[model samples]
Target: MSTPWHIQRMAALDFEASDKDSETARIVSCALILVGGNLPTDTRTWLVNPGIPQEPGAIAVHKLTDEHLAEHGAPAEQAVPEIAKSVAEVVAGGVPLVGHNLGGYDLNLLDRECRRHLGDSLEGIVRQPLTRVIDTMVLDRQVAPYRKRVSEEQGPYQMRTTAETYGLPWNEEQAHGAEYDALMSARAAYKMGAIAHTPYRDRPDWVRALRTNRFNSLRGVTVEELHERQIEWYRRDAEGYQAWLRDAAKSKEKHDPEAVIPTAWPLRPVPAPRNGGDR
Candidate 1:
């Protein structure tokens, strides 16, 4: 017997890549942690051999090197498709794939990887209703827009900062590993929901202030409804950002030549940069 989607789990996703380029970075690893039921359980992690040289800066983050992956990682064709299928199966079963910064980065790479290998995006392979997603970074902003940030490390509402804000456990040693980051994202997502569901009076003073949050609308909502809300939120966010960019460009007489805000809601597909052969 399976738990209902509403009561089942929200999955948190994270990926580490071989470069910083959103369009060209080859994904080195991807991880997802299911957050309902027992939570921090039902996790999946994939280490992929992108068959490309890793940028030094990227190595500084996840620490996976060409030498390391050549020995431990599966070929892109083998690993990317398998991972996509696994995620699609869960999505088809009504699990919402959640993540921090996923819409902007990880999913874009996933789309390209899937197309690069299987000639299909992850959603196309699912061949069912589109998978739902909850972006922790996106939603956190809507929930608490005025949180202070005095430094790069504090980051205001960034994933790591959000975890700290919610008093969730974090391990610096395991911080950048996809599995660890995904787990932290899952916990942060749950913490957001906790704030939404808990009554104001009984909560701690800090949480009590969020009693009037936009996320309050999520309480008792169905998985489908929560998914819909995120779409609406993302649309508003993208348009607002684009408008700001336009205003800035007019003032500076220079714009993001492309000036395109990825309005694909949860996971925008970025085109792969020019390459002779990336196989």
Candidate 2:
């Protein structure tokens, strides 16, 4: 049998934004890294002058300040389209796009930025659902729903912690950089493919300790099939989380009962304008 698509060539994508709001955040930095087979690894990065102030909390996380971006970054109108075209080229070539939490965050942010700056979304350019994308976070949650947090400092499914869980190298100094994070997520996806494709008895003791057979079913599936499976997995996960938030609200916790989690995979729908203009 041929190698699984997940274990083959992939283009890893990541983006750093001005803030945490996917609908409104502007892209501060973005990266794409292509690696696999006998080809030499290729990497591209962009820093955009978002034309907006960077939030203090976002600055602390990515360390790209307003002054720095103003001096060194490309205008959003220029950078956003170039970034979208690079990603479109990757998808057009049949290589999967790998990232951590891309469905919920980065891709949604990119879509909004493209619409904001270029008047066309990434989905508009691709002309299809991003079915060739692989989200390491979604895959990890599906495969290891019972895994516990490593410590107070790191959540169970954070990219850093997930990389560590897969025995990939970690560099604290480079942790949140767009290129570094994208490469780490790609490596993690490669490791996941290894775990999934390996035979049950042949898997390492550490793999056995994960204590689930979820990866077994993932073995040998086509990328499109995997994408469909993730849609279901993500929906179920969101429903469960929404239910938990409702329960928390009933118990007088700080959670909002009316908060709705979107179940869209890879890209979310654009919010309608307040005046009811076409989205």
Candidate 3:
């Protein structure tokens, strides 16, 4: 079997989108952080002028106001592709692009801008089957059984809640600045990766098995056969234990499968001793 890439490259992205309908055509803040391979640990940030006024609520969170953006920000057309370049470079480097909820939110916003600005260049790179996309939200749920996210415990920015269940210090006071968000996401990825204790950790065979679902069978038999045997043993053990539990529950006047057994079913009792002693 071919060895999986040891380099394990991943990209982390965050978008500080505008909340105004007028600025809907433009995004206020965008950033991408590439944290592996030959890439330098640099975060690319963009402040789009958006050609419209910023919403009051958005201004409260990110503090990128209409006046500030109009005075200092670049035009949306000029800024979007620069952001797309950051995305395209990381993706082209054979890295799986990751975000908190890439599937539902971030990628959509990215694709929208990519189509509007870069056109064909964006189409060639952004939308591909081999384009590895990892959603951290899905990964966390599968790994950790139960946990609730605290609202911006480690930062002041009111970002979406996450099941990450850990906190890290970030300069949230900087707020809505793409560079700060990208750096925070990079740090979050490192922290989450350390806690993901799945079978794939440091084990190429397990990763391959998980990806392919073609388990490694010992000796000559197929993995399917071995799996069936294991399942049968598990069922036998489970049934025996369950039967005992049912009987105990019935004795305590609780619901049990055996309690529903018809009277026709033989009920075994303790045998009498040879000397007529208590059995």
Candidate 3, TM-score vs. the true structure? 0.57
lDDT of 3: 0.51
lDDT of 2 by residue, 181-245 (tens): 99999999888888888887887677777766588757888888888888888898888777777
Per lDDT, the best of the predicted structures is: 2
Could you tell me the TM-score of candidate 2? 0.94
Q: Higher-lDDT candidate among 1 and 3?
A: 1
Ranking by lDDT: 2, 1, 3
* Pick by lDDT: 1 or 2, better one: 2
User: Stretches of candidate 3 above 4 Å error?
Assistant: 1-7, 20-25, 37-39, 118-127, 149-164, 198-279
Off by over 4 Å in 1: 1-7, 38-40, 210-212, 248-258, 269-279
Tens-place lDDT per residue, model 3, 1-279, is: 322222345566777666632214357877776665556765667778877665678778778888888888889888887877767777666676656544435665666566556664344544543236554443333333234435435422133333223366544466446656555554554444443322434444323434332212211332233224333333443455466557765436553655322111011122345697531
lDDT per prediction? 0.76, 0.87, 0.51
lDDT of 2: 0.87
Give the lDDT of residue 100 in candidate 2. 97
Task: Quote each prediction's TM-score.
Answer: 0.85, 0.94, 0.57
lDDT of 1 by residue, 1-279 (tens): 433333457777889999866577888998977777655577788898999898999999888989999999999889988888887877877778877877767777787787788897767888864547777887787777667794866678667788888788767788889998887877777777777777767656776576445757657776677777877777777777677667765636644544667677665654555585554
